[model samples]
Target: MKYILGIDGGGSKTTAILADETGKILGKGRGGASNYQTIGLENAGQAIKFAAAAAVEQAAENLSVSWADLEGSVAVVAGLAGADRPQDRERLRAALLAQMPVNPIGLRVEHDALVALAAATGNKPGIILIAGTGSIAFGIDRNGRQVRAGGWGPILGDEGSGYFIGRAALTAVLWEYDGRGKPTSLTKRITSYLQVTQPDEIVPLVYQGPLQRPEIARLAEIVLEEAAGGDEVSCRIIADAADHLVKLISAVLSRLDWCEPGIPAAGTGGLLQPENMLWTNIAKALAGTHPQVVFAPPMLPPELGAVLLGREMLDTAVGQEEFIANLRWSIEETSQS
Candidate 1:
C-alpha cells in the first residue's frame, strides 16, 4: 500500500504522521522544535528526521513494510515557523531532502498555520485561531480567498497567546515591584515558578539570552492559576486575553469570509488543546458578542492535514469512516503509548 507522510513543524514542537491513501493514519511520531529559525539547519534537520523516522517506524511495525518495500512517500505540507522567507524555506527544503531520500514528488512544505487550518476542519473554508507561543487567525471565504490577521510574532502582535499572556505577567511583575501599576499576584507566582525568592532576580535571569518560549509561557498558566484562586488582577488579565482573541476571531470571520450565519470555525494550538481551559473563556466571550460560533474538535494533526492535502491533489478520496477510524486510532495510540 502507498504511504504518505505529513509533518507539522512548529516553533516549540514537531509532529509527524503516516497515513495511507485513504487518509487513515497508520502511525504517528513527535519530536522537538523544528522551526528552522530557532534551531538552524543542522538541528532542524535532525529534529525533522527524528520525527519522520518515528512515524515511519511505527507504521512499518503495523504494516510489515521494510524501508525498501514502501511504494510511495510524501512530506508535502509542512507548516513550519520561519517558512515565510524564501531563503529560509529553501534552506529547510534542501535540508529535508538531504535527510530523507524520498521521491522528489513526495515532499512539500507550507507555513504551520496553513497546515493547521487544513487539519482543523478539512480545509473546507473557515477560520482558525491558533494560540500557542504565537497567535494567528486565518480564514478562507466561500470563494476560496484567504485572509489572515495577527500572527506577527510575540514582539509585535500575538495578543491573547501564551507568550503574550506570559509577557504581560512579567510586565505586571515589573510594574508592581516599581509601584507603577496595580498590585498583582503575578509577581509572586512568576518569581516563585522561576525558583527565585525575589522579583528583582527576574530581570537578569530572563534577559541572560536564550529565553525559552515554553518556560516563559508557563507563566501564563500561573496567571490562570492565580485567577482561579480569585485574584482580581489575574482574572482581569485572563479576561483581557479572551477579549483580544475574540476580537481577532471576529475580524477573521468578517473580513476573510462573508459574515455568513455559520462558519466551520475551530480552535487550535496549545492554548485551544482540549485540556486547556482558556478556550472555555474564549468561547464564552465570543458567544456574548456574536451569533453562536461553532467549535470543532481537532480531527487530525496538522501533519496529517498536509498529507491529506497532497492526497486530495493526487486524487485520493479518504472516506468518512476511514478518516474517523484513523483519527480515533491515532489519538488512542498517542494516549496509550
Candidate 2:
C-alpha cells in the first residue's frame, strides 16, 4: 500500500494523519508539544514519533490490518511551528529521522505557515492569517513570490496574537485595580481565571511563579468570552488585537500584488474562527482597504496540506473531489467515534 504521513506540530500539541495515495485521509493521532524551540529537540522528536505511531495504529484499526501489512518507506512531510529557518528544519529533520517508527522516504520538514497557506488555498496564490498563540500573515502571488509579516515571538512582536490579548487583559485588570483605567468585568474574570482573589497578588504570580507563556496565552479565551458577553475592556482588547492583526495582513498584502475578482484570504488558528471577535473585526477592517480580499474556508486543514506535499513527492494525481469528500466524512466519523 502506498502510504503518506503528515504531521503538524506546534507549541501546544502535535497532530499526525495517515492518508492513501488518492489523498483519502485514513486516520489521525495527536501528541504533546513538539515545538523544539521551546520543548527541546529530544522531546520534540519523541512527541512527533508518538503522534506518527499513533496515526499508523489508528489506520491499522480502521483497515483491520497489521503493522506489517502497512509498513514501508512512507512519504512524509512535517510542518512545524518555529521551523522557518533552514537550520531549524535540518536539525528537526535529523532528530525526527533518528526516532521515526518506520522507514521514511522524502521526509521534508516545512514551516507550519507555508503548509497553512496550502491548506487554505490548495497551492494557489493567496494569503493566510494565523492568530493563535502567535499571529502572522503570509501571502503568495501568481509567480510564487511570497511575503510575511509579524510572527516575531512575544518579546518583540506577535501582535494580534492570543498572548497579546492575554497580556493586554492582564494589564487592563491591573490598571483597573489602580484606578487608572475603567472598571470592567475583565478584572473579576481575570482574577478568577488566575485563581487569585486580590488583584495585588497577581504581580508575584506573573513575575516569579510557574506561569509560562502558554499558560498566559490560555487566558485569551477568558478575554474572548468576556468580549462576547459585552465587557467594555475586553471588547476594546479584542478590537485592538484585530487591528494589529489587520496591520500584519495589510503589510503583507501591500508587498504583493494579486489580480481582481478577489484575493483568497483565509484565517486559521483557535482565535481566528468565523464570526468571532477578531475575525469579525478583521473582516470589517479589511473591507475598506483591501476590498478585493475574499475570505475563503480552508479546503483542507494544515496537516493535510503536508499530506498533499508528500503526495507531490511521489508525482501522482489525486481526485480532488473524491479525496475531499472522503476526508471530510472520515474526519466526522472518526471524531464521533
Candidate 3:
C-alpha cells in the first residue's frame, strides 16, 4: 500500500493530500500558514508537519494501516509559497525532512506557482496566472523553458494580487478622507468592513496590530462588492488589477518563443474568483488582445497537482492521458462524496 503526499503550502494555509499509487485520493488535511519567507522557517515547518501527519493519520485509520508503515512507503512533492529561489527550496526541504516523521522514497519542493501551473495545465507547457494574497505569472514553454513575472512579494511587487487591490482601496479611502481625491463609497465600505467608525483608525490597526497580509488581502472583497454596487472608484481599481494581470501574462508570452495563436492559459487564486468583477474583466481584457489564447478551467486543485508531480518523480508514465483522466475522475468523485 504505497502512498504519495502532495502539499500545497501557501501564505494563508497548508493543505496535504494522501493518495494511493493509482492516484485515488485517500485523505486530506489542512493546517496554518507555511510561507517560510512570511512566517518564520520554524513555524512553516511545523505547519507542514501538522498537515502531513494529519493526512497520514486519516489514511492509516481508513486503511487499517499503521502510521509507521505509511511513512516508509510515501513519496512527497511540496509546492510551497516563498520557495522562489533554489536556496529557499533546499532550506525548506531540509526543514521539512527534519520535522516530519516520514522518510519518503523521493521528495521534491518547488515554487507554489509551478504547482498551480501543473494543476492548470496537467504538466503541459502553458501559463498559470495566480492572484491571491500575492500575484505571479508563471509559464513553461514547449522547450521546457520556465519564466515568471511579478512574484516579488507584497512590499516590492505582487501587482494584480488581492493585497494590491486592498492596499489600493485603503489608499483611495485615505485620499478621499483627506480631500485629495473624489469621494467614493470605498471610504464607508472599508471603514465598515474594518468595524471602525473613521477611516483614520485603519492606519493604526494595520501598523500596530495583528492585521496581516491575508487580512489585508481579504479587503479586496469589499472593493469588489462596492464595484458591483456601481462605485466608480472601485470599478477603476478592479479594472487596473485586470490590466496589471494582463501585463503579467503578456510579459510571459513575450519571453516565450512560441507564437502559436492558441497558447493555453489558466487562472487560479482567490482574486480570480469566477463570479467576481475582477475575473470577468480579466477574461474580457484577455480576449481583446490575445484572442487566440485558450483559457481552460484547472484540471486539478494545486494539491493534487503536487500529487501528480510526485508520481511523475517516480515514473513519468503516470502523466499519460489515461492515467491523468482516471486520477481526475477519482479526485472529482472523492470531492462529491
lDDT of each: 0.74, 0.84, 0.86
Please report the TM-score between candidate 1 and the true structure.
0.88
Clashes in predicted model 3: 0
Q: After superposition, how far is residue 13 of candidate 3 from its true place, in Å?
A: 1.2
- Candidate 3: how large is its RMSD? 2.0
> Candidate 2, TM-score vs. the true structure?
0.93
When sorted by lDDT, best at the front, the candidate numbers are: 3, 2, 1
Residue-level lDDT tens digits of model 2 in 26-109: 778899999899889998999998898888888888785444654574788999998978999999999987787667667899
Q: Write the per-residue lDDT of candidate 1 for residues 146-260, one digit (tens) a residue.
A: 7778888877899899988887888888888888879887877777778778777887777784446677776787887888788777787788887888888888877764765
Best by lDDT: 3
lDDT by residue for model 3 (144-245), tens? 999999999888899989999999999999999889878899998778878899888988888997667789899999999999999999999999999999
Provide the TM-score for each candidate, comma-separated. Answer: 0.88, 0.93, 0.93
Q: How many backbone clashes does candidate 1 have?
A: 3
Off by over 4 Å in 2: 65-73
In candidate 2, what residue range of length 10 has the lowest lDDT sum? Answer: 64-73
lDDT for model 1, on a 0 to 1 scale?
A: 0.74
Q: What's the residue-level lDDT of 305 in candidate 1?
A: 68
